[model samples]
Target: MTAPAASPALRRPDGSALRVLVVDDEQMLTDLLSMALRMEGWEVRTADSGFDALTVTRDFDPDALVLDIMMPDLDGMAVLQRLR
Candidate 1:
């Protein structure tokens, strides 16, 4: 294989690295995504629950978020509603 194409790098207008928050109940998935995002030079943070996701979002103020559709404590839909 061609070493799996690397993900495209993303950056802000000022050439600063982007910040990303990944939220998922599955630890493995979260860890994997964190690694991939970090490879693109992004600042990555993860939360294992919807509540924790919200808390981290507030504190970190990330530029982007990757959330699972299903999760305990407060599903993704609920979290998205609350955030909006």
Candidate 2:
């Protein structure tokens, strides 16, 4: 019997799964975002606040960041500014 075909996945240049960081004050939103990215075969991490996001970003160095603009600790714009 033939094996099932695998879904095409987004990989890094080193042939590793793409890493993604989802940052939002809303737990539910982050959960949904993480789920979607995980289904795409990505490495997903969630941060509940902008401060946490910064820490995760440094450690994870994700290929992409999904950030919410309305976080309590720090806003999306501030996070981007700090990251830069």
Candidate 3:
């Protein structure tokens, strides 16, 4: 059998790599998601807390977000609300 074809890389409207921010209190989960997204050619960043998520969100200006619901400091709902 022939090797599998590579998938197309994700890109933004201006042609830059798609930026994704992953937030989770669990470090393992964040790392796993980051690895998977990076393999797909996305620019991935991870935050371990809601507070840090907000800080990174401001600087990264990510095109997409993967957020966990329950967190120690601020929780996902608050973070999303603040973001809006």
Q: In the order shown, what is each candidate's alpha-carbon RMSD? A: 3.9, 3.3, 2.2
Off by over 4 Å in 1: 1-8
Taken over the whole model, the C-alpha lDDT of each candidate is 0.92, 0.92, 0.95
lDDT of 1: 0.92
Residues 5-69 of candidate 3 have per-residue lDDT tens digits of 98777699999999999999999999999999998889999999999999999999999999999
Better of 1 and 3 by TM-score: 3
- lDDT value, residue 54 of candidate 3: 99
What ranking emerges by lDDT with the best candidate at the front?
3, 2, 1
| Model 1, residue 40: C-alpha shift (Å) | 0.8
Worst 10 residues of 3 by lDDT: 5-14
Identify the runs in model 3 with alpha carbons over 4 angstroms from their true place.
1-8
Q: How far off is residue 1 in model 3, in Å?
A: 14
Candidate 1, residues 1-84, lDDT tens digits: the string is 568887666788887899999999999999999998898789999999999999999999889999898997998888889999
Candidate 3 is scored at a TM of 0.89
- Measured on C-alpha atoms, candidate 3 has an lDDT of 0.95
Top-scoring candidate (TM-score): 3
TM-score list, all predictions: 0.85, 0.88, 0.89
Residue pairs clashing, model 1 = none
lDDT of 2 at 80: 89
